[model samples]
Target: MTTWEPKSDLHHYLRVAREALLWKLDGLSEYDIRRPRTPTGTNLLGLIKHVATVESGYFGNVFGRPFAEPLPWLDDDAEPDADLWATADESREEIIGLYHRVWAHADATIDALALDAAGEVPWWPEERRRVTLHRILIHVISETNRHAGHADIVRELLDGAAGLRADHDNLAPGDQAWWEERRLRLEQVAQAAGQSEPRP
Candidate 1:
């Protein structure tokens, strides 16, 4: 039998998402990790950087427990989306290290507070700014998982690697030739559907 501790369960899932996102960077060159893969400039390293900043704010400042380290890129005067991309001077190790530190800090906050502990989001609209630890945990977990999904797609686009995790890809078994045939079949079906008359 397993005891269901809600907080612990949420934390476990959050860590899963974090690890999945970071794993996307493994075995990739610096250029590959940092290069913009999407038209909107989404990249693997940038995704990690952006989420670190987000977790720092939500788990740190939101609960009146600010993360000790200063993040100049997150400052008000800094350029927009400064946290989204790492500059040439910012090595991959630094960004990854910072995220690990953030995990420690956030875990502390989660440990020290109860699910119902009161907190306030300074940036949220006044009426809804007040929140509980449970709410914040759910919020951050959702955010982390969302970025992890993005990481999965971006990593696949980069190197043809796609999976839910290193050990378990959670994908149907298929070789490259099988996948190619499947893709062609889907494309043909899509074209046929496009040619069908509207059902209005």
Candidate 2:
């Protein structure tokens, strides 16, 4: 049995979220990983890049422990949404490498600070800028998991792959034909309900 402390538990969940997000990039080509799969231009590599920036800011800058690397995407003169996509010059390896570095930085912050250690989010509204390590941990975990969910959908769109993690899928057991039938059945039910509704 493994004994778990409060901070360890939080870090555990955050790590899981991080792994899930990175898993979405596995078995994908450079083009496929960088290609926008949604109307709003969401991509797997882009999501990872965005989360890296998010983690660096929240864990590093907010705590006055700045990341060593220069971030042109986050510069004051940079174009909008610069952090949300990878340019042609940015290789998959480079982006993923940066994300790994960010994970290390964030982990160091978690290990060094107490849960109640104080910090300030300068980018946040002034009234709500003050925060603690515990609050930032929870916030980053939520944000990372939210992006992981988005990655799940985006990966499914790319290659029909969907799972909660590498080992456990957490999906209903069904073959392709069974899934098609399920979809049709749901569509029929929805159509029947629609037909029964009175005209507005």
Give per-model TM-scores: 0.97, 0.96
Candidate 1 backbone collisions, by pair: none
User: Which residue runs does candidate 1 get wrong by more than 4 Å?
Assistant: 197-200
What lDDT does each candidate get? 0.93, 0.95
RMSD of each: 1.3, 1.3
Candidate 2, residues 7-89: lDDT per residue as tens digits? Answer: 99999999999999999999999999998999999999999999999999999999999999999999899989999899999
| Model 2 alpha-carbon miss at residue 171, Å | 0.8
Best by TM-score: 1
State the RMSD for candidate 2: 1.3
lDDT of prediction 1: 0.93
Model 2 poorest ten-residue lDDT run: 1-10
